[model samples]
Target: MTKSLKTLLQTMPKPLFGMGAALGLLLFLMVGIAGGFWLFDRYNSPPLGILESLSEEVLDRDGNLLRAFTTDEDRWRLKADLDAVDPEFIDILLAYEDKRFFSHHGIDPLAVLRASWQLLSNREIISGASTISMQLARLIEPREKRTFTAKFWQMARAIQLEQRMSKREILSAYLTLAPYGGNLEGIRAASLAYFAKEPTDLSLEQAALLVALPQSPEARRPDLYPDRARRARDKVLERMAQSGTIAQSEVARASGHPLSAKRHDMPQLAAHTADRLRRQAPKDSVHQTTLNADLQQRMEAVVRDGADRLGTRLSAALVLADAKTGDILAEVGSPDYVSPARSGWIDMSRALRSPGSALKPFIYGLAFEEGLVRSQTIITDQPVNFSGYRPKNFDMDYQGDVSIHDALLLSLNVPAVALLDAVGPARLMERLRSGGVTTELPEGGDVGLAIGLGGLGITLKDLTQLYTTFANRGHSTILTDQPRSSAERQADASASPIPVLDPVASWHVSGILKDASPPRGAPNLPIAYKTGTSYGYRDAWSVGFDGRYVIGVWVGRADNSAVPGITGRTAAAPILFEAFSRSGLSLSPLPSKPYGAQEQTLAELPPTLRRFEISKSWLTNDSLPEPAPKIDYPPRGAQIEMTRTASGQVLPVLVKLQDGRPPFRWLVNGKVLQANGNRRKVAWQPSGAGLSTLTVIDSAGRADSVSIYLTLP
Candidate 1:
């Protein structure tokens, strides 16, 4: 309104002030909108979506795949890391998918501008602006709709992911989540299925195919659309060459290679063991076992081939373990896991069955430990009876007198039972139980003499564990199929060794068995072994060991049905020797004789051990004199009543005696009752119901008699 204001207005144009006001409003609105967008991105962004689920794999000790299970979504989503992948494949993937992947935080602004320019100029989408991180975000939180909203959300998630994870982690997620057709969800699964190998050792062509398949998995599946897959793979190679990521020569070679026309089945070795370990380790995605892949394969083949020749319904199981460490080297549960006729699904090694003569060595080992008998002591193999139970030789024949070594090597039942009776069955069972072997007696049945002749139930696994003691110099340990953790190893290192047998006793048994005859046509293996055939041939077993390893073989039917011709020496011993041969280890020599172990001849043994004798006080040394004989029934002057038998005849009067020198003579009414003087208990038929005299005299000419009046009922 003043003179100065009038002069300024006269200098300025009328259109200029109005245009300036409009420009200032536009600048204010633009700044306000940008500030609002920044607040929304900072506080309201979606989750990063980086923790994708993966498949669980079971591997051998060397990390070779034994089996793989699908992810929760039924997809083979094996985990992959950038370091574990082929460097060439990573390079090709980066060059083809996102060249500025490392330089950009998540979304590349320059790429977005270029793509926008192309879309506007050519009216078509030419190249994607999404970096690898952006692509990975979309994969993790997939949305089917290709709307602008979904694109914006994915970009936001990508930026968040980049901020949380390193570049290698981003690339790893991309490699892991990328689809490769038909439920195959990762680079590792794709490489294994298509090329039957690991991604770490992928060929150039294989790498390119894997790199390109994720772009259009269904349309470019190598198994279904080979031509399309080949084209896509070659296009990736061409791009790689153009970008100087790979040599031109490499591109040519890779392009010339043919695409895989079909997918391959995944590796499925050690199926039973893998399944067991997976169940035990549910939370672990990778289960590593102590199994040796090559040895397991060879042993499986050996069992299958052996089972084939053993006839129908017959199966075989073998377990090989490291003697010192108790780590199971190879375990074949059955010859053929899928054979229905053989009942192969059953793991026979764990099945409870009688172990026939396989237990004889333990009996003899216990006897030796008790000093009741030596390996060379003479034992009477003549027919013998305990009360009414008579144990006969397997052949129904007898050797008059044989050394204890012959009795054990021949698996003579009567002598073994006699020794068991002297030592007591309860004592023997306690020894086996204390050594980490489980022995199952009949339902509600107490330990009896028959158990010495395979009358109890025992599994091959426990039997093998017991045998390991001899190979381990009387030390016992449990066998493990899983790799020990650091804590477990430390615990084992500090634990005390379990004693199964005295070193001298174990050596004595092993020394005797090692000289036993081998199966016909087989070499005399340096290993010590024992054979066992159950009653009715229901189970045949052979367990052998050297200094380092113990191998046990069982051949039988799972149903417990007897095979007529099956016997340990014939059906199982040969397999035992062959298994040791295929173990791929040199034979280890047996342990040297322990100090204070007496390896004496038969004549050099003490007077008591010079000949095997069964007595209640039999455990005493030769220096002790024999106890005096005493009649158990009918005191010096007592009345006795005799009962009638089932056939309505007068039952015999049974006389029992205890503790006397051998060849004790029995006399009734001053007449000799029988010719045999060694009888401990004699049954005499009463001639008449009157006062009778029962007299027994020891070989030392000592006499003791009881008089009783008997009334027959």
Candidate 2:
């Protein structure tokens, strides 16, 4: 301590030292206030428990509502955001609930002062000073009673919320958690329930009514007390007009609007689809599907109508899809969703059922691709045994020899089985699997000719996909229920493409089936379709396609029981045509012929293709040799009478042959009645009633002739 230093310190004023101590104390106090605020904010943060209880929604491709599941508490707490609500509703809310909602941090002092003054001057609590943020705080941390303590806590939490979140966030929270009436929490839920629409497009009157409901949810419930709700809504309109939130004339018009008398039922279209999607998505998340609600409704109607006409215990499933994109446009799992008699709850579209003759087209297509047969190629439809496993046609009779086009158009069983044998069943199964179809073969059973006739099990969805590949020019893509995102689409584009069949083969099959006669009385459609009836009539199916769309239909007893007289041509083909008609799309023509394809008649085809020949070894080594030529009909020297009707129609004589090679020639009275007859039977129109000689010649040069006298009736 130097003497100079001591003198300088002693000259300092006592007031200056006192001021320094006061400043130090003020700095400490400031630090303490900030520390207390930080601690309070950390402890008083808004709870987000309400957000976890939001309702889950399933939407269509256009974001239209499909279905929504309520919270565990049975509350309709659909998620809401500031952008999703009508601006008019927000305006009315702020003007009526808290005018200074945007400018004030959390609490409005002027509003508090005004409320306090009114309470004191009137000796009653007439108005509330709680801003929207304060209300949000109370909503998140609900309290049973409105006490001074609760109000103070709410104000503190609101201040903390204002510091932590943006104005829009706070407003969204309020909109999402606000109560409307029983079991309706958010604006979206209330809007859907009361008005049967979205909150994003509400009228002024609807907006006012929604704004008023949150103030006194129970007392102002429109469904329970329409008059009280009208009054509350008008009060909101009055405030909105006074605050200039809306024009006075608009207010008058809004006030004159009526309140909703009852709640509306939520959207229930595509209920099964929504349920399936919800099971696959995360809880409380939104799911969007590629289903078209309108199309789905129409398909359901079609299936239901078909099922009704088919009688009891019968169900129908249908699927419609975009051929190019493989997007499932509509799916009907069953005709009626609640009919126990029909087992309607089961999703039959995904169920494994025998496809019957529905698969014959693919076999024929494969044959065409292999160059083993053509549309104009002649095929034998006579009774034939393959290793002792004989296949009989549905009618228990065969047209002895027919062109490939006629065979496929008639859906002949023998020709299809013979073709399947030629193409090898294993190859057909492999082709189907490569095309994204799942075929269920019997355990350890070899691929056999029966598979060509639908011995194997396949779902309608997979079958539809397989047919869609034909419409898509023989390329196959996976079908999707939901629209893919851009990234997913890109990834799919990078994946290797799957080829189902050659383009020419697919086109040939489509061309042949397109000309097949439609079901009786069905309007002619430029579509390629096939009908199938499984063994014992257990399942009936019809799959059809054009250039743009493919539809598959299944009708049967869900229990796999046989339904008598239920064949594909009768029960399913009509439904298939009706489905196309109800789809509301113009019929698309079949794709243009592939470059290598050329239409020709059987006589114009090459010699080898003019007749389908399989080696005796392919059939069986135990088979007997070709029988000598013989004529069984117009038996040797028998008199046959030719009849003419009143309309002057001449009747023909029937010529039948047995145990002979094909390409047989017939002669009547030395005049050739038929040249190169390929069947066991032929009809000859008698020129006159006289002695007629019928002669038959086999391709091997063996000849048999029967002469008979034709007498006029």
Best by lDDT: 2
Badly placed stretches (over 4 Å) of model 1 are: 1-52, 281-284, 486-498, 517-525, 603-607, 614-713
Q: Judged by TM-score, which candidate is best?
A: 2
- Colliding residue pairs in candidate 2: none
Worst 10 residues of 2 by lDDT: 640-649
lDDT per residue for candidate 1 within 233-278, as digits (tens), equals 9999898888888899999998999777989987766766776777
Q: For model 2, how does the per-residue alpha-carbon lDDT over 1-713 read when each residue is reduced to its tens digit?
A: 99999999999766755777999989999999789878988876679788788887877777777778888889888888777799988987888888889899999999999999999999999999999999999999999999999998898889898998999989988888899998899899899999998899899999999998998999989999999999998998998888788999999998988777899977766666776787787663688888787788799899988887766567899988988777788888888878897798888998999999998888988898899988888887866777766666765457888889999988898889899988999999988987777889877867888898888999999999889867877776667678998777555434526567889988988888888778886888888899999875678999999899999999987888655456799889999999998789787777787787788777788887888875454453445677667776656877644434334555565566765677888887787888886777677787788877778888888889888777654
TM-score of each: 0.77, 0.79
N/CA/C clash count, model 1: 3
Q: Roughly what TM-score does model 1 have, to 2 decimal places?
A: 0.77
What shift in Å separates residue 626 of candidate 1 from its native position after superposition?
Answer: 31
In candidate 1, position 263 carries an lDDT of 92
Q: Kindly report which residue stretches of model 2 are placed more than 4 angstroms away from their true locations once superposed.
A: 1-34, 282-284, 486-498, 517-523, 614-713
Candidate 1 Cα lDDT to native? 0.81
